[model samples]
Target: MTLPAKAIGAAAFAVAAGLSILAAVWAASAIEGKSLRGVRAALEEGGYTWAEVAVDGLQVTLTGTAPTESLRFRALTAAGAVVDARRIIDAMDVVDPSALGVPEFTLEILRNGDGISLIGLVPSEGAHAAIVERLGDLAGDGQVTDMLETSEHAEPEGWGAAVDFGLRAMEALPRSKISVTASRVAVMAISDSAAEKARIESDLRRRTPQGVTLSLDISAPRPVIAPFTLRFVMDKAGARFDACSANNEKARDRIVAAATKAGMAGKVNCTIGLGVPSPDWAEAVAMGIAATAQLGDAVITYSDADVSLVAASGVAPDLFDRVVGELESNLPEVFSLHAVLTPAEASETRDGGIPEFVAILREDGKVELRGRVPDPLVREAVESFARSRFGSTAVYAATRLDAGLPKGWSIRALAAVDALAHLDSGQVTVRADRVKISGTTSQPDGRDEVARILSDKLGEAQGIEIAISYVPVEVPEVDLPSPEECVEGINAALTRQKIEFEPGSARIAPSASGTLDTIADLLKDCADAPIEVAGHTDSQGSEEMNLNLSRSRAQSVVQALMGRRVLTGNLSAVGYGETLPIAPNDTEDGREQNRRIEFRLLRIAEDGTTVPMALIPGPDTPRPKARPGGSDSAEPAASE
Candidate 1:
């Protein structure tokens, strides 16, 4: 291997240069391998299997279709963690988000006495601002807390319409919650009364946007029963409640249970309401009812903290005394007791010589005040009270001044007049010893109402005899007819002879009474079928006035039918006003046609949904029973 020094040096230099180049290449390859492994491992562990990692020298490259822009950004972040951020190269393609689909947009608006609050995401910032502004206007001095977010996407179909409908509902309902979406709107609200709740629900459903689903959960607060009255009577006609009321469900159940145990059969409707006289109302009522049952042939009335117990003429004196004593002692301290035992035979008057003060209420809402009055001042007061109750023109006073009348004669006369107002037609006879109310009434609780009025107005010790009979609506015994058939028959009758009302009044004209009689006969057989008595008017008056007038006319028809002993339990009175016109209002004949009374069959489901009978599929079916005072919808028939 011996050689010259220059030659050896050149050979060594070449060998050394070649080895250095190989080492340099090997180091670069190792670095690339490490980078590739680290990045690939990082991507896989981060659930980015769609990404493909590559390394060239010191640069790391990500290449593949990412499912989302977020995923693509995530891939770059993962690669950067493994290598220098500056050295990481992003060659990834993001999948089109439009292909995936747009997000769902929703809005929730809540309103209460404290004010209103809005929440959820909207399609645009403009929509968010508009919604907030509308709610703020409605809130007045109340607060409007906005908790909304916006997106840069187009509003979905039906979104704007649904929101607008929901806003309108919110404006009407002070206590409510409205949930809005593209396809549905759900409203939950509280109303002042059952009637008000029905109105709100009907208005909302009627105005719901087309193709959008609407759900309603409207509640009416418990009614405030002034004087908190409850009257239970058990006699030859069996047991019943005149006007039962309780503060809550638990109390109502307890009171009803006591009545049932006291031989009150059938369904007992104990109204759950407010203004309880005492916390132990149920207990007190139960004890009184139980005492009445034990005594046999007795009447019990509770007016606020006052309890009145009257025993029948046949009740044993000893037994009456014992029962009365027990009830009085067992009653809560808040209550005051007044017990009375009738004689074997009720006397006509204190001495059978005092003139009887008679006030008669007729079916036409007229009251005839006759017989006697204590003095001129007493006469004036009695006439004024009668006029106030029975209407100014409806009362006819012809009482002579009598100075020899009893001390409380004026009060008895006033009380008699007041009680007479509860009956459809009745006579109230006030005497020194007793006040007798005898006549027929259309009210289900007419007798009870009269009893309560007299018991409250007169002292508990006052002798009272109520021979008032309920003129029960006669439901003709026949095969049940389908609702549609019933409505068609009614419309057919209307076509032959229309039911005409007095000009600008709800009163059925004297000539129309015969037509009503014929219609009443037809309705007797179809008492259980669901029907809507819709009233429409010509466009001659203000919209609101027309609406009210139409409603009164519709209700008047129902009342007229009731007076004819026809069962109108299934009838619903709805006023379309000028909204539904059968003919052009420009012509007198056309206007006459527009002013109509239509009988439409309503499809009422067990779940309380009301829709037009035509919209319901399948053959028409007979309703199981009568349903009163429900929201209604149906197709109009011939005008009257």
Candidate 2:
């Protein structure tokens, strides 16, 4: 609104000033828009995707996070390209360098008849090409499948040597799996035979680089033993060992010595392998061959520890028996001997129609005379010989006088009585044609002695048919070892192999059956013994569960022994559970050792009081853990 002259002048000045202010505001907005567009274009061209750009007036500002400090600086430089370098404001934050971590690396190499395969993380230094090239050079015609990934981490120390060693090992191990790490390499291989297996293991161990640990598990197929047998045959021609399986080198040497001694001719090749009953294998086999050799025409065979010897019917009965008895007594505790002494031929048993005389010596120390004696002179001489050989108080004359007696009847009868006197209980049969003497004695060569005596007496014209046997005193003899000794032996055996049960269960494992078999064999010699079969367990489960499991296991062992024909009449089973741990249960090995089976002997006085048994320690005895106060019932045992 226009008013007067003075008011008009003031209006004009105000209007001009308002127009100037409007133009400046519009120009400033245009400059800001242009600066923002230019900075954005520079940033896009420079590839700063994470950088944020803003404009106010002529100043350019940044606010977004940068992947790295270098990227952030490049973004600021790009913005300055469009404006003065001082006009750009750097507010961008770079991420922490540690946020991007070093990579972890691993590798697996698999080999088979088909070819080789590689998989897993590896250092990117060689990339996939270098590793594949190395594999091709080593693997030869084997197809190599390279499926590898890589990381930027620096290669670990010793990584190269370990990888090289691992690959070389894989070359030797045709069918194998190799796991490689920075410091360790594990190789598993299979060979067609044990010889090859040994070679593979030896080669691998030699090639493993220093500072690198190599775990090798090389395997071979089990040798098939068609019947797991051995046959040692000695005949009139010679002696030989066939299919002899020795437990060790010492056993082989001893067995060979035995065979050669019995006339085994030529080189003996005994196979050494896993199946052997005991360490005294050679000694037992040698003695067996010797027994067969004593028998003229015979064959002795062994299946594991079962020994069988068969002699032809015409073999001297006394000799056959003496040889067999010696073999039985000399054999190791693990062996069982079965001997067959066929009777003499029927012709040998028939009478020759000659005047025969027989003398019988009973177990009661009484001597009975029968059959025909020569004239009174000869009869008296024969009776006098018996009285001289056996004490006069023990001789009884029951002979009839006969002039038909042979020329040397008196001499033969006297010799026969002298031979009979050496027997425990036996008979002597004499005839003009032939003299037959038979009896049992403790003397080792008692059977062959009669022939020499008769020959000396009859001027080598008389032939004596001898049938004598020798029986050694039984083992553990009439006087048994103390109960403590039996327990010690059982415990020592247990230390070799513990009776194990299934995990989290009371059932015995199959591997335990072998140990149980050994126990059963031992108990057979202790038939009269009252032994305690106690079961123990690790501290793994609740006391009640462990107690129940231990009891079941002990009962199972007793039943198993009984199944093997062991006398359980004097055997009992008990459980101690986790209360009696032999070792700490914290470690896996300790826990395994803590779970065990123990045996103890029970002795009772005539008054029914329990008597603790103890034994002197030596090569024959193992030290007792403790002397139990009572029997293996609900009471606490003396030791673990």
Candidate 3:
């Protein structure tokens, strides 16, 4: 091993150099390990679990898909905090923000007497500016508070239309809250009255843009009533309320329920308003209505705290007294009752010297006037007025001239005649002190009309009694013809007059208009009947050409009928294409017969196939007279 002095020195130096290289490598590996561990720990502690960290030779690299750029940046800062900033490498990627869902854009505009306030997110700054400007213009003297935020997204479909509609609606309703979205606009407002509410709602609905859903919550405040009034009557004509008023919804419902129980029918509109005599107004009204119903024929009127009850002329005295006593006893302390028992013959004068006038209207539309008139001139005027109302031929006047009659005797006679005109069959009696109208009418508000006429003509204080009853007018049902009959009838018309068309063309001739008119008239009564307008062609052309030509002809006929104001919803056009020939196509006459259009009755089978409907035997259905050359095979004529 020990050779020479020079050789030994060289070997020693080489050994020293190899030892130094190994030490440097070990220190570098230790530093890299320490840096990697520190950076990974820092990222984990900072909640950047998505980040991947690696350190190689003093350089730290971070790689991963971070949920956001802020998160990625935070991870890098955290890694830098644990190591040298210069050694850190950012290989991290933030997730694409476009992958996230688009934000919803909405706007709510509230407008009141104070001002307008807008709040919500908009698609862009343009939308925000448009909304602010529109609201500012609407505000006028009031301030517009804009709290709308903008996003840089595109405007959604229907957003502009809905916003414009909402703004228009807001303009219409001064005090309203409008909520606008891409597809809907909701408006909540208050109106001055029920009529105003209805008008506003109708206008808003009519003006709503297409594809935009509209929601409306319009309310009308209760009106103020002075000397609140309610008048209910239960007479021979059934029961009804002449005038109804309540303070609130509950009170109105209670009053309506009482009226309904007392035999009132149909919808009853009870006014809910401000002035009420007492909180127990509904209670008093219910009790009064019940008592009137018990009496059978009575009238009750309420004016503020004063109540009046009047029994009919023929009401049982004992029953009237008992009901009136009960009603008065149970009424609220704030109410006062005035009871009146009409005499049996109160409609007639107590004195025999009071000249009476009467006009009787019969169901046959004839009027008979018999009474006493003031003079000849007055009598002529009365007769002339009666003739004008009841028709010249319908009137028969026979009144004795009386110079000593009352001052308004002519007026009373004329008024009686006028009132008599409204009754289907009834009479009007005019006395010196009262006017009595008794009749049946088809008008639902006949009694009210008569009362109004008397009040307007004679005066409200004049003694007036109405016994008008409403009788619903009955409508007679029409018997429509069966589908087979309808087709047969149409064919019958076609047979008599052939619906001629241009040679080898679908154009209908002008001469065929009369036949079409006849058929159109027949179809009006049975437009709902299913019918097939089948077209046929002779074997003179290709099957396809014949089929298309026949179909066009059939459709042409249907269109012609439609032009004549006939309904074609149930009519279908079908081409036989020379398939179902009634006659041989070899001869001219046979071909003529084969090239005709026929109507077949249609019926849907269980399998959804349309088959020819069977002919129904109907002897009662009148058939038109057949011409000399008309075909009488029960099938309608096929026209070319």
The clash number for model 1 is: 0
User: What's each prediction's clash count?
Assistant: 0, 2, 1
Per TM-score, the best of the predicted structures is: 1
lDDT by residue (tens digit), candidate 3, 257-310: 999999999887577788798999999999989988988887777777877787
Q: Against the true structure, what is each candidate's TM-score?
A: 0.54, 0.28, 0.51
Task: Give the clash total for candidate 3.
Answer: 1
- lDDT, candidate 2, 318-340, per-residue tens: 89889888888888897888777
lDDT-sorted candidate list, best first: 1, 3, 2
lDDT of 1 by residue, 281-343 (tens): 999999989998987898888889988888887899999989988888889889998888876
The CA lDDT of each predicted structure is 0.81, 0.71, 0.79
C-alpha-based local distance difference test score of model 2: 0.71
- Colliding residue pairs in candidate 3: 491-636
